[model samples]
Target: MRNSVLLLAMGMLLATGQPGLADDAELIKNTKADHEENGRWYTSDDIPTYKIAEDGTVDWPTFSGFRRYNAECFQCHGPDGAGGSYAPALATSVMNIDYYKFYETVVNGKQEVNAAQNLVMPALGENKNVMCYLDDIYSYLRARGTGDLGRGRPAKKEKKSEAFTENENACMGE
Candidate 1:
């Protein structure tokens, strides 16, 4: 009778699925769903295409971001963040990027690693809605600057004077 009971217990263990297996599958499914959502979060439709209309109405908080960027970051980043050579161009930077990243970098600041001119950014956590401002500032800069903001690299520079010849008659196509 004892041997029979042991056999039965072994059968049950084999027949029943192991505990926590379902949880793993559920976790995988949840993770996949989250990735899908993240992929769509930055779609073009989600982000506004135009910064300012011809009439000169700037996007909300974006204008504020511009003010803050100019006041706080322009010195190192340049007027439009194209680059200054002395400092990494925000337009072309691959580090501490994006609204969330920029906001965090600004608010928390950063530690200088190599004693380069780059200084630790002071935390602007005190600033209200700085994230939104950073987002708008990013949009404005990306819209005006030449580069892919998503890639965090500037577009290759084109040859200058290609379009217009040295001759005054170049536009006439003579």
Candidate 2:
């Protein structure tokens, strides 16, 4: 009876278009199903989610992350997110920053000047290459930051899902 009432309330909330409730419910369900870790949600089928193998190979998203990071981010952030002489170490920094902050920083960029140095991060929101694979990059960096994924190319990876392909096509406008 309580479950029925809760379901009805959720239905009504959905019908009313109240923001976040449906997503929250889905997040709750996914969390209950063990699709979340350390506050990061993992949608294995639709979005890029990673898994580590016994021999230390990561899933496709993490692999994609490695590629994307090296291509788009390495010059500024340094190899393996270790930070260049100019930029901060993302491998360590990402672990402390919230997802929204990271997103905002990447998309809008940041500039800070202290007594010692001035730092600038150029906005990449308009760059389709980065935007399209932002999640994957984040996943890889987060994994690295948490020490869950090691530096370098993974030897093996899980296959990409049809949903990922579909989403990628839509995002890329293909």
Best-performing candidate as measured by lDDT: 2
| lDDT on C-alpha atoms for all candidate structures | 0.46, 0.73
Q: Quote the positional error of residue 71 for candidate 1 in Å.
A: 1.8
lDDT digits (tens) for residues 36-152 of candidate 1: 121111223243222333454444333444555677677776766666645567755422233445556767877675755555556766664444345545554544443322232
Supply the global lDDT for candidate 2: 0.73
At residue 107, candidate 1 shows an lDDT of 72
Let me know the TM-score candidate 1 reaches against the reference structure. Answer: 0.43
For model 2, residues 83-141, the per-residue Cα lDDT tens digits are 99989998777656655677889999999979977988999999988998888887788
In terms of lDDT, the poorest run of 10 residues in model 2 is 25-34
Off by over 4 Å in 1: 1-63, 94-98, 115-118, 129-132, 146-174
